[model samples]
Target: MQRTLQPGQRCEVWIAGVTGESELVFTSDELLLEAPNWTLDGSALILNGDGKLWNFDVAGRTLSQVPLAGIPDLNNDHVLAPDGKQIFLSANDGHIYRAPLGGGAAERVTAVDGSFHFLHGVSPDGGELAYVGIDAGDFSQPGRLLTIPAGGGHSTLVDVGAGHCDGPEYSPDGKWLYLNTESFTSLPGHAQLARLRVDGTGFERLLDSETVDWFPHLSPDGDLASYIRFPHGTEGHPADLLVDVVLVSTGDWAAPLHTWPLFGGQGTLNVNSWSPDSARFAFVAYPLANTDSSKDHVRD
Candidate 1:
């Protein structure tokens, strides 16, 4: 089975189980395809693209684009509200905004100065939002993973002075908050996975890898996690982002369950949301090529 969609066309979600047939949910036209998100109840879909947030009705096949006034470009990290009615996005300028999925003005949730905000993920309960914020300093220390109320309130700092932590994802049960930390002097990709309590204590190392392991997304039932693994060396420009799926229980990084090669080369993969049933996930491929308007492209 196949579906036809243009570059920005909104369509239904095609689902294929491990051994069953594929099915479509029949959604409205595509509103914005930049970053599409699925609601918790699977009734609605939210998308953020080209400086706009859009809501789509799966059954009605309708699209509503929300207006975000006074907002700059959106950061890569964004989360959906637990109730599936709101979209939470992070700004590079150290602020988070919440906009209704249907269509309305977005409001600010965080207002910390000199901080670089990145959206990690939402809690399972949807009552709190988890994010990573770095102090606007010399960029020589680790960022802080914080928990804030979904409705809007003061932010509570969870981790402090860890040096280089990035990409925080909550476990399906919300009992463990996992993040990646690194000690590299230049690259944030030189990081590993660590589990921390919700209250910010009892930190334990889950896996250590010479390469970078980022964008940890737990499956719906909490059995597995899918992430992108970039190798350690760069041949010409930068290392390619390789897709990898791992079993959570295998804390020992001796071997991974399955590994696949992404077609794009010399680029990074930015993964955020996973499918509701955990059958597949979505990610963006960023090419790190140095080019001009007219130049020959080669695979180096």
Candidate 2:
């Protein structure tokens, strides 16, 4: 069944039942915000706006603020360990940091000084971390996906192809890692999803589309994937980020089962969490009203 809203301005949550279409579970003015990132356990939702991490309980509908000490001048492109023990987030200086889920302090995990780097995703087993690194001088060359121990150790180069790669998420069973890779020479701003073998052999392209695809979050069953699509048409002006859920079969993305359209042209739509049954998902929307390079949270 499909869901169609009446085009209201409030942020709401919806879930699909065993039969019939999805129904509204809850709507809140205090909970949802710009760039909300959800925890992997699906019990709490995390929203990062105004430079802080806020946690909201889905079951209780309560809110708690997490102190992101030692993590200053950075954004919340982060992932929680499957056991809900640690969080791996990126810094504006191009490094990855690991912090306890209880929210006290963070420790630096990767160091690529004079270069820009960011963590794409963390392995569900909490054993390995996948990230992208590039030279500060050149931003066009394909970035490197480095797999290192979650507790901080030597890094292993996973892929070095000539395409920009970012936003990696691992399967629930810890067998496959999915990411977005793009090239500028042959394909300007095209984005596609590629699957990496965790056993250290290599990766294969799962879905290739001209639209800029990013943030592929896999469901608990590992049969479905949700992502954000920034189509190529809205260049220069703010790009309209489209949230989509796709069904996968035999390692191939079959079709986009559902999609949520964006209202503001230059804002980003965040896919932070997914329900345990894979019937519902949560995200934060920010509409960029204008262009300002200094502020990272501003949508326009």
Candidate 3:
């Protein structure tokens, strides 16, 4: 399958099973949506498109826009709080904002200027936010993993010397923070999954391979971690790629337990989409027709 995506293309949502079959949950008219975050109650999937947010009910198969009174330039780096009541959104203005999940005016959470902040995950206790920060003036510079008070306050740098990093998610127990980092500034850089203490200690790589890995989301039970893998030498994560959703035992990261092949990348598994019970996950796959053959299996 060709791995290239264009604007205004078609897409679909899928609820992936652990050992059985995958089911189509919703389909979009255009490629406007990116990243599907399962609602706390698992009743609906929240997605973003063209700077706006919408919620699609799984049972009713309906869609509704999530009202944002003043914020317009929203990105895919938004995540719902652990409590499932508030949402933290990353805007184009280089600031993160918090707002009610249902819909309302978003309040700025980061006070930084001339920089971009992309939210990745919220702490399980709903008190802190983990994200990747990039210097707006230098696109070549690697992004830094940072955290801040969920209520809005000064941010603290966690990955001090890493050249590039992305997808900073918190573990359920709140003891460790997981992310992907590319240590070089050159093109076709190799990226690998890693984790560190919440206080920025005991940093180590969890999974390293030739294929560039991004966005490692730990299950609610912290027993398994799933991430998207871009083909080797892929410059950056782009949509419509023949990517693999690799699932690994959190207790043993040496090998993936199962790999699901699909015709989607980037938005496919950017956020934590595991169900409350950790039995399944929600992911967005582009162009409904190509997903019929996408299935899961243990790697050879």
Candidate 4:
């Protein structure tokens, strides 16, 4: 089902410094904008809104719809290619596609049967893609991590553990794939940040935290990282709840360098939005008016 803004709610796009406060870059009282992918040039953020793609200009604080032909409504799991000229899309149709960032018809990339693909990461060399696959389009089942040739081919499974995992993205050097998984604990829906070698070995938890961590996005320099933290016991990253966008050192995920509190979850930080220089990152917040009773879910 399509996501909708709650009554009297608004969407806010923000840019945060690694060690300073967050700046509101843009806002919309109606449009529901999801995951932002920072352009490699650092001038704009590409986002998905109203089932289409858009480029949110950082300087002008404006939006331009990306003309993508021959594709279904997109999900928040879109990823920018390492080349910067192309983007990989995960559509609601349960397939993936590759398209020019400058705008054109998207070429279908995922042809595998029996599962729905949710793209998360592109390899540093742009030769591969990392994504989560839901068997037979079943949202209730745990997503399995898989990789395939960027141009489309047979996928290879890269298992982390039994519980569900998401936001599998490659490090700058391409040596590791960072993600959030529930493999570390028996507690239901207790996802934590972790990583694994690209060769499918050396799986390690990046942090031990009480909050539910999802989407570990590394900066271009691989020195800094960002992720969204849900309150403890939250079953999956849902929308309209209060959450935190955290920045941390790649060397120490357990120690946060900064955290921005807001009212958002699912589409908030679903993809990497770190600027090319790694000084700042982008995220979205969906805040409802004070009168909305849903605000009661804000964690204490």
Candidate 5:
């Protein structure tokens, strides 16, 4: 479901460290923003808000809209290209697009296939993209993982057990795709963190938990990871709910390095936000109108 913009809500964009330190960089009691992707040069973050994309300069602490001609409203599922000059965006129209990072006209990357593509990762070499395909735009059908050429080509279906999956992201080394899937259990909406070999073999869960985990994003160095944890029994990653932005070692996901309790759920950590050096990552929080979450707490 498309979550409408909450004009009365306060949108906060924060930068947090692996050591449990965090800083509020930009904020407004206005429209919504989601899925901030750090630039390769570490100068800024790109996020989608109010059905458009904006660039938040990290150093200047300012926000600016990214001008793209002829592109529809975008979803939170977007990934930066390995070249660092382009980005792949998933639009509300259920198609993926390629556009220059600075701002330019976008070119459609997906054919008129029967499925809607929600992009998550671009190969390290920038040759392919990984996304969850909802066949015929049917929400009741399980999402199938598919990889297509970055420039648009035939899609290859990846089997990840017969359950709905989201956030299929590629590792920096390009060997594995890390994501959340429900195949590990029969329970509905129970997404657990897992990884699959690029050849679609060796699928394994990173850790077992009752928490509904989604979107496992590894740092560029392959040492640290960040993901969103929804409350138990939550049907999906919905908006305006209490959740955790968790940081853990890629080697041991069972042990969390930091647990950030905040008021945002779905849009908070849906994409990779790690800085170029892996020292920091960005996330957004959408506090509900009735909640007093301004004094949110962080745990070590």
Candidate 6:
């Protein structure tokens, strides 16, 4: 099957039990909706598409656009505030903004020129935001894990050293920051999942294997961390590859508690998608068009 950017993408909301099978809560024909976050009240799932945000009702199976009037060019890096009252958005223009969760005009959060900032997670106290920032024109250099005041202030480099660091999510307890790091400019080296203190100390490598892991999302309870694993040697986080959503015990990252294989990557699990209870998550998977070259194949 050849994976085309056509309209075959299926956006799914799945609930994975701690000790049981995963169930699909919702599915739709809408394609390219990425990185969904559940509303705190658990009433709806919020996602981004076509440079705008969207809200999907879980019970009614209905979808509607979020009225972000003045903001455009939104990316998948947007995340909901810990309080669930605001949304942090990263635009293609390399700036970050925040808007009311209910839908309203967005306000600039970062005041930088020509710097790309990608939102990953907000602190549990709602005082700081964890993100990855890099030069807009430099793809060879790794992005630095950074933190700034939630209200907007000078950004602080997380001092994770050199690597393509991404997905800087904070633990529910606000004690540690978890993220993924790959070699700055090499393919032979594998991407590893890691965590460090918010003060830039206590760095530890949680998972290192043949698979390239990215975007580790800590459950609301802080007991589990779920992330998407790409095939070994995949240069970048490209879509349409055979990937797996691997869940690991936060206390013991030695082995994955469970692994669900799927036909999606990149857009899948780009941001934190854990439910309020932390038992379920939302992700996107694309169904490929059947063709001679696309026979249940996994891209490398």
For every model shown, the clashing-pair count is 3, 5, 2, 0, 0, 2
Rank candidates by lDDT, best first: 5, 4, 3, 6, 2, 1
Off by over 4 Å in 2: 1-37, 60-62, 137-140, 183-185, 199-202, 233-252, 264-272, 287-300
Q: Write the per-residue lDDT of candidate 1 for residues 25-117, one digit (tens) a residue.
A: 333343223334667676555555445565557568666666666566564457777676777887545678887756567788876566766
Over 4 Å off in model 1, which ranges?
1-36, 41-47, 54-67, 137-141, 183-189, 233-254, 263-271, 286-300
Give the Å error, residue 88, model 4.
0.3
In the range 1-300, model 3's lDDT, one tens digit per residue, is 212245555677778766535687777665467778888897888888777888989899988899987775777788898888888888777788888899998888887666788899788899999988888736688788888899888888885355588889999999989888876334455777888999999888887577889898888888887888889987657777788888888988768777777777877888888878888887777744534533442243
> What is the C-alpha local distance difference test score of candidate 6?
0.78
lDDT for each residue of candidate 2 in 116-135, tens digit (9 for 90 to 100): 65665777667888777777
Please report, in order, the local distance difference test score of every candidate based on alpha carbons.
Answer: 0.56, 0.59, 0.79, 0.90, 0.91, 0.78
Output the lDDT of residue 27, model 4: 85
Which candidate do you rate higher for lDDT, 5 or 6? 5
What TM-score goes with each of the models?
A: 0.70, 0.75, 0.90, 0.96, 0.97, 0.90
Which candidate's lDDT is highest? 5
Which of the two, 3 or 5, has more lDDT?
5
Estimate the TM-score for candidate 3. 0.90
Worst 10 residues of 1 by lDDT: 291-300
Q: For residues 194-291, what per-residue lDDT tens digits would candidate 5 score against the true structure?
A: 99999999999998998999999999999999999998887767888889999999999999999889999878999999999999999998876776
Q: In model 6, how large is the Cα lDDT of residue 54?
A: 85
Question: Candidate 4 residues 215-274, lDDT tens each?
Answer: 999999999999999999999889988788888888888888887778899999999999
Clash count for candidate 4 is: 0
Worst 10 residues of 4 by lDDT: 291-300
Model 4 error, position 128 (Å):
0.4
Report the poorest 10 consecutive residues by lDDT, candidate 3.
291-300
Q: Which predicted model would earn the best TM-score?
A: 5
For candidate 4, the C-alpha RMSD (Å) to the true structure equals 2.8
